[model samples]
Target: RKQLVYSSCRAESAGKALADVMPDETVHNILLTASLCMGFSAFSYEFMPTGDARRFNYIAMAMTGFCTIGYVSMYNGVGVIEVRGHDVFWMRYLDWAVSTETFLLGLAMLSGADRWDTIFILAMDAIGVLCALVGALIPAVVAPAYLLGAVVFAAYNYRLFGTMQVSADRMGAAVSAKYKRLTTQSMAAWCVYPVVYLFCEMTRALDETTEVALYACCDVIAKCVCCFLLLSQP
Candidate 1:
């Protein structure tokens, strides 16, 4: 039934321009450029000298690497599904699932979090992303799923600022400061996603162009800018 609906929608839009059926050409171009930039940046991490902090480079690579693939898929007009009248970019959710886990892993490593703490936090993040993905796909479940994702996000932040912050402090003043900065910046960038989803996917308050631009900007900040900051830290 779902496939039938998607096919019918595509068939109906066949008479329309390509942008009307899929993503706008400019947005697709931007996605392609962003993917290439992230791919190159991830590759450049290979030359960094190995050490205790070098592991963070690996985490950054994974985050950007996944995003690179996701954006490239989007550029190629793949991984997008039509639900109702809206185009849902499912690949972004997949990218977030992996990238956010590696992101939290880097933070956990910096804070010296125990294995259990790390596992628990990663689980919460995964559940939150899953909830968001479900909400995007199913119109009826949007409210409940959004609320659930928001709650899970809150819980993740609690653990991050509570236990993770404490552990970072124990590491030393420098580690603690760096951890706080990265966490705060990343969290702020993450908060934009739910807002974008609410407006673009659920409420339809924003148009597709705005949605793509906002998401693209947020991805750059969260993955590229934050990863650069993390790698540049002494």
Candidate 2:
């Protein structure tokens, strides 16, 4: 369904002037797919009562959708160790997507977290994202920065996940249970992302196909399943 939406939207945009002038226009397809998903999640929000977790879930969907748009160019693990593909793969405005979504998710989780807790998560994720972004854009020259960002991201990502678990305990029963499931499961599922990134970039153990597949699995579990779980809450 996601691919279908991406393809259709990509096709429609192919004839427009931007498509004609821009290089490798198909990469923009992710934005279309994400927008469609965001709209669907927004529409689905109406099914839940006012002020439910579904509202935040809808925002998460949008965040996931929009943030993934930056893929300067996807690296398939089969071959090529060129430097161009690594750093700052934000041709499609990845900086915007990641930074915004990090902010959005931290903000949304505030429904269940204390101000200090939420701010801490936001600060770490923001710093991590910025560092990671810088690292991604310039892996060769500023590899240390990227590595540091990855450390910040990997270390703090788990911390932020734990915060969600703690927050879940304090919320009302319905919200608590859902947040618990969402946070715990999301943390575990995403365990594969960092590993995939590191091994793919370093050892080349997995082909690009496997790398993408792992990422897709993580996304479906983290975003899609979590959204539905939130929708089903109460």
Candidate 3:
């Protein structure tokens, strides 16, 4: 009887955690989510010391970051419940963030590219998104699509980093250092996203409770934490 009662309580607690948007937030996380998105967007275009040559690129990247909260919210966004608790796991769908970001990020990286670079990046993005969206539509292709995206991403970042070198030269030493830091952090965060997607959305061994918890943690790391890191750079 005691074991049964304990199990039932755990189930209830998990359910409540998924259902509530607030548990113990210092500030409502949804609002914080929005704020971070907007904050990063504003800083990227307005305040950051980036040159005008990459202005369009900055806009594309900023928009990608701004819109990514949609995916985060869909997965399991959090909010403050009271002073002592927090709410999470309100939704699900790990691929949304990854798929969408792949396309936009490619374009953002493509900004200021010459014809050949532009064509290559666009072609790869189209294929990558096709795989991801088709998998999303069919559910059967999701896992394979993620694997394919990893391959494309390796190429994408390689070429993009090469192009960024030109921009880095134009931006100068102090500002270029900041750009390098931001790129490194952003790319590192992106790597975490796919791992979460695989575990939470692809594999079936983990239960919904554990999957959602992992998704929640990784989502914050990839989105919010990266945003602050970008802001902190001089």
> On a 0 to 100 scale, what is the lDDT of residue 163 in model 2?
68
Give the whole-model CA lDDT for all candidates, comma-separated. Answer: 0.87, 0.51, 0.52
Task: Give lDDT tens digits, candidate 3, residues 86-183.
Answer: 22232223333343354334334424346676666556656665554444345566778888877887786786667754555465776566566666
lDDT of 2 by residue, 17-58 (tens): 333333232323433444345446545645656453445655
The positional error of residue 89 in candidate 1, measured at the CA in angstroms, is: 0.7
Q: What is the TM-score (0 to 1) of candidate 1?
A: 0.88
Error of 3 at 83 (Å): 37
Badly placed stretches (over 4 Å) of model 2 are 1-54, 64-82, 85-88, 91-111, 141-147, 154-167, 202-210
Give the distance in Å from residue 232's predicted Cα in candidate 2 to where it truly belongs. 2.0
CA RMSD of all predictions: 5.2, 9.9, 10.2
| Model 1 alpha-carbon miss at residue 144, Å | 0.8
TM-score of each: 0.88, 0.59, 0.53
Candidate 2: Cα lDDT at 3: 100
Q: Report the CA-based lDDT of candidate 3 relative to the real structure.
A: 0.52
State how far residue 151 of model 1 sits from its true place (Å). 0.5
